[model samples]
Target: MPVRKLLSGLIGGMTPAGRFRHACRLLERADHSVRGFARLGQMAGSGMVAAQYQVACAYLDGIGVPRSPLEGMRWMHRAASAGHVEACFSLALMLLVDPPGQDGADSLLPTAWPEGIDAWPDPVAATHWAGQAARAGLPDAQALYGYLLATGPESVRDPEAAGIWCARAAQAGCPQGDLALAVNHLCAPDQPPGSNPGAVAALLRAAESGLPTAQYMLGLLHERGWGLSPDAAEAEKWYARAAAGGVRPAQARYGVMLLRNGRGNSRAIMAAETWLRRAALAGDREAAALLGDLHACGKAALPGDHEAVTWYRMAAEHDHAVACRMLALLYIQGRGVASDPDQARDWLQRAAVLGDVAAMTDLAATLLDRRDTPPATPAQAAAPLPDFRAMAQAGDPVAAFNLAVSLHRGVGCAADPAQAAMWMERAAEAGVVNAQYWYGRMLLAGEGISASPSQARHWLERAASHGLPEACIAAAQARLEGYGGPRDHAGALAFYHRAAEAGRGEAMFSLGAMYGGGHDVPPDRTQALHWFTRGAQAGNALAQFMLGRYLAQGLAGPVDRAQARHWLAQAVAGGVTAASAELDGMMLADDHAAP
Candidate 1:
């Protein structure tokens, strides 16, 4: 392990031309046995970790070797054991695929390394490898490792460890690690105060000190407050600095931000898009991911083009989790592309493999929905459906909620209300607003746990804190009804106001009615009319009808017969029967006077 001998070992490894020839030869031997890689896998000390990874991949995936996942796995570990960074990444990925303990063997996970392998699933697997590689100076691995250590659950991740790696990487002139590390820490709510400020300072310092990746990250941070206070001005400043450094990503990001926020020196929206396209071609995942989204969503800014899926597919090919989710969603929804349920499942599986919770939830939902769409038989339902509970246990909020629902109601599985309560509790604690609502309901009713109204109120308050408009409305309703809690009209109005601000049409209309009727809050005809008008403009049909009534009856606002008729027409169009009946009666009266 001495530096001189290690360097000598590396120098004595394959020559540049020899490594190239070896890689090329791998193409011609695509059908060879993976076991042969053990003999051919020897890389000179000069062979970089990435190059060794290519060899490990060939052995594990049958890319250029005979199909033998076991041999491939063994070879990958050998390289990993030798402290190769990419090999460590592959090993970590394998571990995630086959979580070490208590994961049922049937989970289709990677077989744990057999006896004789020197390495095991170390808690800091990803970081350990990255640290070694980073210390020797590898930018991508440093950034990746720092990010993993900073954000992954404590079951695997470590912020202090992440900080150490980030500092080393930053000192060694790897700017991307600084920005990515900042984001990693920023994503964790439990971090000590000033964690983000310190991380952002490091990123800014690195960016200003001339690391292109840092500059790009600083631009993003200032753009979205990724780990720092959002300041559009500062974003543009860092972006300009990065652009001056010839970072294609910075130019594209800066252009896009200008276009999005309508700031100074605007790139023609299309021009900005063109810069993103350029960055995408240059292999920027962020650019490719953004372009894919733009193409998929087609706005006045980025026209909806199925071709965006193509770009997304390309980016996803390189293991971009967001791109993977995007592609899976498209395939599942059949949007701007042929619908392929199977392909959607495949992409979702891949995305989940890359640790995408959204993809995992969608996949579980797809299976559940597919069963409903096609109507699986009772026997089929009895059979173990895909273990979506794994995803919930793994920290997918939606999945956690759905898992609770399934257990509570016995959908495609047996009913287990007690278990359902446990899952719901987890989802609620994790901040799924709907789950919070349900968990509160369960607590209030003692569905599984013992009755605890105080706990129920706590959960409801948390849901309200998240501004789930529906939950706020429901909680307000509960409070007003004095169900499991004391009545507080003032508090109810506060929640209704929150729901109204969040654009709950029903809540908005109700707020208007309460104001008009002097219920909940003091009656203010003017405020009622204003609220009704605002709600109607926001396309709330009920509000439209109520506002029309106010005008026609001269209740809350000055009568405007013509405006009343117009809003009445709108309400009728929305299938408001009372409005239709009123209009019919009015027209009949008008006809009676027509002569």
Candidate 2:
């Protein structure tokens, strides 16, 4: 026999009460036949609210019928209008929570029912039914009505009325009601101090009922001393509980706390790493970044380099600027990855766009190095090159210096020495030592701006004080030539020696010339030869030419004719006109003496 026929025959002789009980029993069984439920629904009359509600639940849950929310809602509405409290609450929830579908169809009940709730959700109807059930002392309805009254649309929101309903639900032992009331009190800035105790009590009730959000809130209260004394131990306990319950923020906070206090405890360190990894996998950005740093530094027994790269890449993909910058450095240095300048530059540009100052400086330097090369991809070609002027205007000193270099060299921009000089001065004023040296040199030479020897000397001196070798040499030259204030031979000698000791070829050549000419100290042929050799080895053309001539004439030491010719050849190749002329003369003499 078909199950529906069998169920109909079995219930055919039962009284109305017995039939309702039979239907409820069938609906409660998970394996009851759909056809059986459909027959029972047909038998349920409008007056039998219990049977109607049970049949409606079967259709709503697809328990024993062809799931038809429309049929279910119609029966539920019939029961609710007939004063069934649970039925009214169910109907209210369906109307309030289920939204209408895109084509104006009711999402909750797709099939048409002549007397269903509505084609679209009706919050007004939901509120009416919920109020009716709530007034009948239903705890769930009371809590839900209170929440809706406080957070519903403008016309329905009533915070004071919400409080009354919430209190009623809380007194009936509703955890959600207690949690909401606690949150309301916590959010009210004008609440009296005495209200905090009530809020804490409510939160405790909710937390004790195993609500993860309430537990997390309690942890925060203890951690931040919000209406309570700050108790790190208590906070950690609550955080651990909430984190185990899958609260993401609690997971992150607990992980950080463990890591901070796990210095000498191996167990705590491992626990911290586990929690941090869990939080990071759950999409906590701070947890991911912190994990990256720990791995990068090999902190708490983490594997370095390779593991750091993995975590940093994760955080960088999430748009963490510091992580992007760190990842760029790793790529540039081949730390746990192949050395890839392009990849490094790409990461650097990403970080720079995210407002990282160090990234901006590094990115500018990289761009300048590759300015002459063709862009590697269409995106690179289409992307407008970094605008140095814009960055400089935004107050980046490195950008100002880069802009000056670009303008002076006509690299990706028109050559404009005047503008370059102006930018250089700006960079110098911003305390860039290299910019100070270059700006000072430009001032002395009057390359773009009017010459100001005194100002040039001041800038050069400032740069030299910061230990710039080039600045030391420039400052020495200014003093030696009397271009900046009166010539000071002693000061010039001191500055030249300082730069030469720092391995500056120009300073070495200057020191050799001074010794050979007896300009600042007693003439010392040996000292002159030593300085000239050092400068020549450093590739100074003038020094090479002077050393070659001296060797050819045996003025400073025993002549080595072969070494003299080699030095002269190097000088000529380096574009020394005097060296070229001297070599030509030697060749001419050799040709005349040929037998």
Q: Candidate 1: where are CA atoms >4 Å away?
A: 1-358, 366-385, 391-399, 444-454, 482-491, 497-503, 533-541, 562-595
Whole-model lDDT, model 1? 0.70
Question: lDDT of model 2 at residue 99?
Answer: 39
Q: Which stretch of 10 consecutive residues in model 1 shows the poorest summed lDDT? A: 99-108
Give lDDT tens digits, candidate 2, residues 1-595: 9999997797788887886666666666776655457557766664677777877787777788766777777888888988999999998898876533434554554555446455447787787888899999999899878877776666887788888988898999999788777766665557842257877888889888998888988898888887778998888989899999999889989998897777647788789888988988888877888888887565756556667778888889999998898888666544556446799899998999999986887676667668789877887667655678888988888789888878877877999999999999999999776689889988988977999999999999888764456678888888888877888877888888767765677888888898898586678878888999999998899899989988877988898777888899999998999999887877787689899
* Local distance difference test, each candidate: 0.70, 0.80
Which has the greatest lDDT?
Answer: 2
Q: Candidate 1 has which clashing residue pairs, if any? A: 10-45, 10-46, 13-44, 13-45, 14-44, 32-66, 60-72, 298-304
Candidate 2 scores a C-alpha RMSD against the true structure in Å of: 16.7
Off by over 4 Å in 2: 1-10, 15-17, 31-136, 148-157, 189-195, 300-595
